[model samples]
Target chain A: MNKVMLLVDDDDSLSKFIKICVEESGALMEVKQVTSVDKAMDYLQNKGEFADKSRNPDPYVMLLDLGLPKTSGIDFLKRLKNKKEYAGMPVVILTAMESTENIRNAYCNYANSCLIKPFGFEKTKELMKSVTTYWGRYNRLPDRAD
Target chain B: MDKDNPLVLLVEDNDGHAQLVALGMRDSGIDHELIRVSDGTQALEFLHKKGKYESSQQPRPGLILLDLRLPKMDGLEVLKEVKSDELLKDIPVVVLTTSEAEKDIAKAYEFHANSYLVKPMHFDELSSMLQETGFYWLACNKRAY
Candidate 1:
């Protein structure tokens, strides 16, 4: 079965690029894109429009962007990690900021991994390939009840 | 060396498994230096720079590949201690073990392990997994320190 990935990022172009790269990587993964942390939470909880389990399956991994409108990615990470139900979820932070403090904060908040948003087409493609191959294909997740 | 090529500390008691991991990393062609410790106690000692490691000049490892079962101490105990330590918590600790029990997976994540990966039974699959693991953590994943 193809694994579901929740991508929370406001950047339309980058999100589209990542979606394309991940799909093209041949990893069995379906990327669900959301612009805000609230939308991501909704998706995860199967609330509102995401009520259809078939359409919105539980994501095995989440690619979180540090920058968001109100609830920042770091803040979202803290919230998610605080929930024991979301303990097994792997949240990988994708950000353009190379700030040491931001990176430290993300990991300190229990982010599974952090990767700089790559520049240009080739680098992004390579990154997506590695991301999908590693997280989607190889990394194992705890069993989640449907 | 450089941030892109950080040292990897592998904590495993099995000699054969450790050798396979080294070979797999070599096959991946990613520049890395792997230091091995046989048990969970030594793993913590190396991380905290305790006892024999007190005078060691090795820089803080960028990644830690931990095994669940070990002599002296268990992997989960080591994981809990590392994640609890402010200085060590930031480092990515990926649990690499043979057990795929649901309890183990859930527990590792509960301890805030960076990731959990089951060691493949076949030699070829193990090699492939190590390559992907090494490539992703060492090359693709960015570190703060």
Candidate 2:
């Protein structure tokens, strides 16, 4: 089965654009967009709307937004780092914020990597290609037997 | 070291800044394909080939241009994951954000990020920085993969 990618962001429109950018690469990418921190956690935790495999499978990777409402992205990172079970899951922060404080704080919490949001679909297209190529192999996840 | 296929991965959330980075790379004629992600979570999803990114469109990146500040996970989380993973650890991850904080830089190095770059806010300065970044990372540097 193909791996899943969860995109959690409050910006509804940007979410759509991100999906298109990944798809435009034609890499068999399945982009899932959630609007809030709670919803994103649900997707990762396999609760709520994310429980269904067809509708929302376990993401091989997650693109998280930092400034999420309800549960802040930083808080979410802390939770993941705190839990050994989910620590192996590679989580990259992608957001509009570019603050030194956030960067330092994220590393202190043991985040995998921090990224600012990209500009356009064209550039995004390129980013998708690179991300897919490398990230796909970084984690040696268990191959779910069909 | 100047291979175009190994592409650059730019993980930035700001649309305007992202454009400048792309343009800067373009101006330098690095001729490398760039993949940009908005947040750290997205960056990880893309790197791990999970979530919406099961299949891959291009080859692995030669360099990663990462932004320190991100929405969900932030850059440090992303960096730790990349460095910890045996398969992806060797791949260069360059932190590119606007933080001049010493702690941020020190922590990034501690996580084993390949490099750190503070993004210039000014358009002209940013452009020059991008060009230099492209030249250094894409051209001058010796790439392992």
Candidate 3:
């Protein structure tokens, strides 16, 4: 079965591109896109409109964009890592930031991996392939129930 | 393994297994120096730069390849220590071990291991895994430093 991927990015076009890439890479079954950290948290917590657990099964992996409109990805990461139940979820920072400080900050906050957004379509696709192969296929993720 | 290459600290007690890992990494497209430690204690010592490794020339490793069933301290213990420590926690630790036990898998993730892989029986499979690992973790994945 294809795994679910939760994508939190403010850019609609980029998120759509990532969804296509992840599906084409044959790693994930579906992509749930949320524009802000609040929405992402609502989805994860199964709150409000995201109340149906069956429809919103926990994501196997999360691709977070750092430069969100509100509640930046770094702060969201810190919050997620602090929550006992959500702490085990693997978070991969998918951002355009190539700065050393941002990279170090993400890692220090316990991001499982960080991927700088590739400039070209093919490069982005290739990155998605690597992400899927390693995280989706090889890496042993925590049990979904956990 | 070239000295100038990024260092990969490998913790495995079995000599034959360690050699196989070295061989696998040798063919992995990314080049890196492989530092071998037999037991969990040695692994910690090497990472902490304590014990005999106090004057270690190698800087902190960019990545760690750890085995579960080890002597002295065990892989899970080593993983917990590394993940909890402020300085060493950022370095990715991939649990490379033989056991496919569900318990081991769960425990490794609980401690925040970057990834986990059950060693394949075939040499070719091992080599393939090493390639993928090196390609992703070394080539694609961003480092904190």
Candidate 4:
């Protein structure tokens, strides 16, 4: 079976760019993009449009942006980590913010890993490749069943 | 030898695979010490300083390359124990194994393994994967502890 990825971000263009890049690389079987933390939660919870598990299987990895609309990424990270059911889900922080405070906060909130999002196309490609290769091929993800 | 560089503990039963990993780390451009253990029991002994390793002066490994299949105490058990421990939980445990089974992957992550890597089929790919891993974990990643 093909691996799945869930990308949570507010930027449509950025999400689109990543979708295109990741799809082109063929690293993930499917890349599900959601614009807000609420939508992401809904999808994960199998509500609304994402109620269909066959179409939207639980992602093996999640790329979460720190900056979001209603619920901030850090807040989302904390919530995800606190939940008993989602404890095993690996959440990698992918964002433009590179400050020490942000890094410390993300890790403190129990984010699995934190990476700075690259700006340039080539750099973005490299980052995406690394992200997929590291998470999909290398990192062992927790089973959604548990 | 860079004395100040963070140490890595590699646990693998296959001699050939362990040597390849050694070679990869040696040429990885990131200079650091890599300690090798042949089985899961030795890994625990080295970590807990039990038996012959009671007086061993080796420092706590900043990174651990653990194999799932072993002679005694499978990798999952080791991971569960390590992650549950107060002192050892902070250290990153990267599962390096040949199995790509979903169950294994799920179990490892559930046990809170820091990362997981499957051995590459080709020599060059293995070396490259090791290079990327070394650079990412050792050079870039910020350790919690």
lDDT leaderboard ranking: 1, 3, 4, 2
In model 1, the fraction of reference contacts reproduced equals 0.84
- In model 1, pairs of residues that clash are none
**i-RMSD values for every candidate model:** 2.0, 13.3, 3.1, 4.4
Q: lDDT of each model, Cα atoms only?
A: 0.90, 0.70, 0.84, 0.79
lDDT, candidate 4, A70-117, per-residue tens: 889999998997776786677888888877678767765667777777
Score candidate 2 by DockQ: 0.03
User: Where does model 4 exceed 4 Å of error?
Assistant: A1-3, A20-31, A52-54, A81-88, A96-110, A140-146, B1-6, B25-31, B39-62, B70-73, B99-103, B120-132, B135-142
Scoring model 1 with DockQ, what do you get?
0.72
Candidate ranking (DockQ, best to worst): 1, 3, 4, 2
Residue-wise lDDT of candidate 2 within A1-146, one digit each (tens)? 56677777888888888778777877666788888877877877678766875667667667788888888988988787666456445577776665656655665555555566768877666666544533453223333321
TM-score of chain A of each: 0.96, 0.87, 0.92, 0.93
Clashing pairs in 4: A138-B116
Evaluate candidate 3 by giving its C-alpha RMSD to the native, one decimal: 2.8
lDDT of 2 at A50: 67
Local accuracy of candidate 3 as per-residue lDDT tens digits, A39-127: 99999989988898888878777999999986999999999887767755789998888788898888878888888887767777778
Residues B1-145, model 2: lDDT tens digits: 2335458888999998898889988886777888888999988888788888878776677778888888998889998888777666657777778887767866775675655667766888777667766764575443544
TM-score of each: 0.97, 0.51, 0.90, 0.73
Per-residue lDDT, model 2, residue B55, is: 84
| DockQ, each predicted model | 0.72, 0.03, 0.52, 0.26
Q: What is chain B's TM-score across the candidates, in the order shown?
A: 0.96, 0.93, 0.95, 0.94
lDDT of 1 at A120: 79
Alpha-carbon runs more than 4 Å astray in model 2 = A137-139, A142-146, B1-145
